[model samples]
Target chain A: MIVVLSGGVGGARFLQGVVQVVPQQQITVISNTGDDREFYGLHVSPDVDIVLYSLAGIVDAANGWGIRDDTYNTMQQLTRYGNEDWFLLGDRDLATHIHRTNLLRQGKTLSEVTDNLRIQLGLDLRVLPMSDQPIATHIQTPAGLLHFEEYLVKHRSADDVQDVVFVGASKAKPAPGVLDAIKQADAILIAPSNPIVSVGTILAVPGIHDALHEASGMVIAISPIVGGAPIKGPADKIMRGLGLEVSAIGVTRCYRDFLDVMIIDEQDAHLTREIEDLGIPVVVTDTIMRDDETKAALARTALQAAGLTI
Target chain B: MIVVLSGGVGGARFLQGVVQVVPQQQITVISNTGDDREFYGLHVSPDVDIVLYSLAGIVDAANGWGIRDDTYNTMQQLTRYGNEDWFLLGDRDLATHIHRTNLLRQGKTLSEVTDNLRIQLGLDLRVLPMSDQPIATHIQTPAGLLHFEEYLVKHRSADDVQDVVFVGASKAKPAPGVLDAIKQADAILIAPSNPIVSVGTILAVPGIHDALHEASGMVIAISPIVGGAPIKGPADKIMRGLGLEVSAIGVTRCYRDFLDVMIIDEQDAHLTREIEDLGIPVVVTDTIMRDDETKAALARTALQAAGLTI
Candidate 1:
């Protein structure tokens, strides 16, 4: 199994690329559920859904989230019913939430629901959450503690982050097969998702980090940060808030302990020496995934760096 | 306190009149939750939402359910996703399902979420579910068992009803305050809804019928059947399936145990003696709620019969 650790958006995009170049059945995605939140009583797993939709080839390319051509009529009516419209839930997206919620209410685990959804979407790949337990990522900002969605969606990630706390992570165990995916993997790829909130939040769960450290598979991470900026979202701003530089070197240090190979952008070729100085293999390529072809190319390049091109 | 036992459509219209006649806070609606179902995992309580929308004055006048001017864009997309679209769930309706499903996943009771919806919609009336548990009304047809929605919406009630069963009825407990609504009410008016599937299903829940039997309040029912046919839906057909007449007298017998008065349409005034023979008081009026004025007039008439018009 080729297990991939992912956040939302950028990570989902890279996973989509990986699925395109490789056999989907051979791939397994261990998604970060730390950003999960209960909105309007529905379990909204942004990263999990992003990876699912992206891998299913049904993600809205323009937004990098939500189903393609989905309507917002439901969200508009929700506002009329006096609901806060900070989180824009698309109508098609609502179906996924509804199905997941129903199964959960029936006492099924999140892992089971995730698997069923993948099957329903005709996906051959396995998409599992990091944990079935609720692990909420909370951003401690100057305004106060805010749910990750409130920070990312409602406030548009405008606040300065003082600290990031993953609630329930301490009590959370790795979901079934997550550790197995790590142990049996030929390679483990960490997607180019937001480092602090996505990848950092996943590592917050105790056993997941240890599993990565002990896994025999070659572990590689694609740089979400290019030269000194994220391709999308507030990763750059969040990095600065945490008193870290927004560069390939910063990304390398973040994954230094577990990372076997690091992939950076060709624009940041000058930083290769610094990245390699950390005693990790560094690969430089055009890491900006502008389209499906570019994403696939990036995926292929990252795999080659780990000596798994075949 | 004004207590209204309601279904959808006509029940919603009756509740609208009740809201206009009484102080909103004093009115409590014991809405049928037998129509509740998990369509793709969203908890959709059609009757409760209809009453809510009607009370909020946002109900679609044409369809008599969902929000006015709600689009079907989501429904159209659901088809693309290969979902069965026999039941019409508008985009606006999806929001309610999403919100309810999400809330339910977080361990909130159905009653609590419904109250929250009532508050959100600015409805001052207390809308209590008939039962908090999942008690679905299934019709055993020639084709086998079909859900209430499939029998009603999908097939348009064309199937020959061999028998009807309220699944989970034996296990269902009346929602909090449902029994209280019956006992404390000065009067109880059953709206002109499907006697079998709607009102019958609500009464099937344990403790509800017993409470009504012992209630001190004057129990009145507006006949859904008039002349030889139903005002709306296939109540007459269902009545026939139960080996009962498709007239006002048939409805009186169905509710005879606790029924104090039977309200019939002017067209069925001739059936008064036959109903009165059952020892239930009979009133003939324009029971067909053609407009808001007629509905309010019906509410006033029912209140006057119970000596609570003031």
Candidate 2:
């Protein structure tokens, strides 16, 4: 089995390619839950929903998030009720949150709810949250600490990040089957997602990072930064605020502890020697996924980097 | 102040007329809470919303419930998630439930949440739920006892109703202003609603009934039935199932204890003397409210029956 650590839109787009190269049954996704938050009392797992919608072929392709043809009637009404309309919640997308919230309230863990959603959406691949326990990613900014979503979505990530903290990481244990999927996998691929809030939060979970080191399978991560900038999101701004170089090398440093191969874009090939000097192998390639062909090709390169035959 | 005890569509329609006759500020709506239920963990007060939407002039006039131009995207999507779609929750109407649920979770009483909604909707009238505590109306059917919504909305009142029960009524207290509104009103008008579940549920609350009896104001009821049948809903079916006559006399009997006067449709003029024999005065009129003029006229008649000059 192939295990992929993923975040939101970028991670979801990357997985679309991975599915093309590998059979659905052979893949397992350990999705980031730090981006999860309660909206109007409904638990919304942004990252998990993006992956689910993308894989189910229901995601709005243009936005790389939410369901296609979704209506904003609920959001518009919420605005009329004097509610903050910073976070956009589409009508169809609300079903996922409502269902998940109801199940969670009924004593079902996040993993169980995700499994039920996967089955209902007709997905063959397993998708698991990093941890069943609630963990919020908060970005420490010059203004004040803001929930990761407030900084990213509400404030449009305009705030300068001083530090990032995973609120419940210390007490949160990996969800059932998360560590097992990492250990039993033939290879592990980390999608090109925001390193600090997405992949970083997953690694912060105590047993997960240790399991990545002890696993027999090779671990390869596709860098989110291309040509010293994130393909999407505020990865560059956050990395810079945290005093890290905004390059593939900076991303490599974040996961260098357990990550075996670092996949960098051809634009950053010049930094190969610099990344390799950190004791991690560098696989330089064209990592910008513009279409299905390119996404599938990038997935193939990451699989090869993991020592997989196909 | 004029206090109107209400149910859903019928009550809401009657309220529209009441507003036309009396200034909005002088009206207090005591809406039934027994029809309230949680859908996907969101508290949905069907009766309360109807009254709010109607009074705010945003109710779907065609259906007599929900907001105008509301979409069912949320319900359709929930169906895709394997949720029972019998309860049709409109996307725009969901905002009220979402907001109310969030506040209730925060330890705010339903009365407080309702007040917020009323003010946000720009409504000058006071809309109070019958009670702040959880109370559900259940229909004891031949098949089994079902929640009022299930019996009405889901099954379309297909089951034979043996009796109607107000679950949690014993412990439930009237909302902060409910009893006071009833006691302090110049007149208490029972809207043309389902007597068995709508107005009946409100009267089931212990203190509210006593307040109506102890109050010096006249208590008047408008017959929901015309001739031998209700104009809308399954009032006749449920009334007959519970071994009550499906006519104006049956409605008069329901409120006869505290009801000082009743206004019946001209079609039921023959039964006026019979209702009067039960020690209550009767006013027969054209009660079919097809337009604003008719609704206002009906409201004026009820007000006049309570010895009001207008």
Candidate 3:
């Protein structure tokens, strides 16, 4: 089996490529919960949903989040009720939040709820939450200490990031099957997602980085950055805000301790030597997943870099 | 001010009539909470919503519940998630449940949450849940012990109800404004709602019955029954299941202790003497609220009987 550490939209799109290259049943994804939040009391795991929807081919491709053709009737009602509608929640998408929140309230762990969702969506691969405990990612912006969702969605990531804190993270343990899956996996792939506040928060969970440190297989990550900037999202802005270099080298450093192989985009080919200088092997490729072909090709390259013959 | 003890659909329509005659600001509704149940972890107060929607003139007139032209996108998603979608929840209607559940989780009382919903809906009058604490109405049917909505909505009232119980009744105290509203009301109206589960549950609260008994103004009731059967719903079925007379006399008997006057349909005129014999005054009219005119007429009669000059 192959294990993957994933974040939101970008990660979900990368997983689509991974599934096309790898046997679906052989994959296990540990999705980041740093972006998880409650809107109108519904526990919304934004990353997990994007993964599920993207995998099921039901995601709104244009938006990279929520179900395609979904209605916003509930959001309209919430607006009428004078609740802030900054974070858009579609009616069809609400079922996931509703079911997940309900099951969580009923004492089921996040792993169990995600597995149930996977089965409901007829997915072959498993998607486990990184941890069962609630870990809130609070972003310190000029606007105050805003939740990650507030920074990303509400503020449109316009504010310069001051700091990121994953509350309740110290006590968080990897969800059931997460560590074991990593230990027994033939390869571990980190999706092309934001390094900080995404993969960064996952590593902060007590036992997860330790499990990665001891993984028998190579831990490979595709650079989300192309030409010294993220292909999508506010990764560059956030990294710059946090005083981190905004390039493949910067991303490699985030996972440098446990990373075995780094894949850099063709545009950043000159940075290959610098990435490899960190004592990690580098694979040069066009890492941007522009279409289905590019996504599958990237996945194939990541697997091959981890010594998987495909 | 006038205080109306209410249930679902039928009572909501009656309230529409009430609002037509009485000034909106002069009205306060003590809505039954026994039928309140958690749907997918969201607290859903059916009767209170019905009353609010009806008073705000946004209710589905034909169905007597839900918002007009509402979509079922969320309900469709719930079905896809393999959850039983017996109780239909419109996408717009879900906003109320979601908001209510969130506030309740934040330690807001049902009264406060309801008042907030009232204000959001642009409703002028008060709509208070009968009690701040939860009180579940359970129905023992052939399908075993089912929640009120299950018996009513799921089974479509097909199964024979063996018993109707207001769970948590003993511990329930009247919501903050409930007792006070009734005591200080210029008129107390028991809307044309189910005696066994609707208004019955309100009376089941500790201080509500006594408040009605000591009401400064007339404690009046309009029988939900029009002839030998209720205008809508399983009021007759549940009444028969409990072995009570399913007619005007039966509804009057349900409120006999604190009832000062009862207004019933003309078809049940023969039973007027029977109700009056129990020391309550009676008025005969076409109690069915089929249109704006009928509803307004019924409200006019109830207020006139309460000695309201208007």
Best by DockQ: 2
lDDT of each: 0.86, 0.93, 0.90
True lDDT of residue A188, candidate 2:
92
Which candidate has the highest lDDT of all?
A: 2
By DockQ, the candidates rank as 2, 3, 1
Model 2 segments more than 4 A misplaced: none
Clash pairs of candidate 1?
A41-B102, A41-B103, A42-B102
lDDT string, candidate 2, B1-310, tens digits: 9999999998888888998889998999999999999998999999999989988889998988899999999989889889998888899998899989988999999999999999999999999999999999999988899999999888998998888989999998999988888888999999999998998899889888788889888999999999898999999988898788999899988988899999999999999889899898999999999999999999999999998986
In the order shown, the candidates' Cα RMSDs to the true structure are 3.6, 1.1, 1.8
Q: Which residue pairs clash within candidate 3?
A: none
Tens-digit lDDT string for candidate 3 (A153-185) = 889999989888899999889888889998999
Model 3 DockQ (Cα-based): 0.83
**TM-score (all chains, Cα) for each model:** 0.86, 0.98, 0.96
The backbone clash count of each candidate, in order, is 3, 0, 0
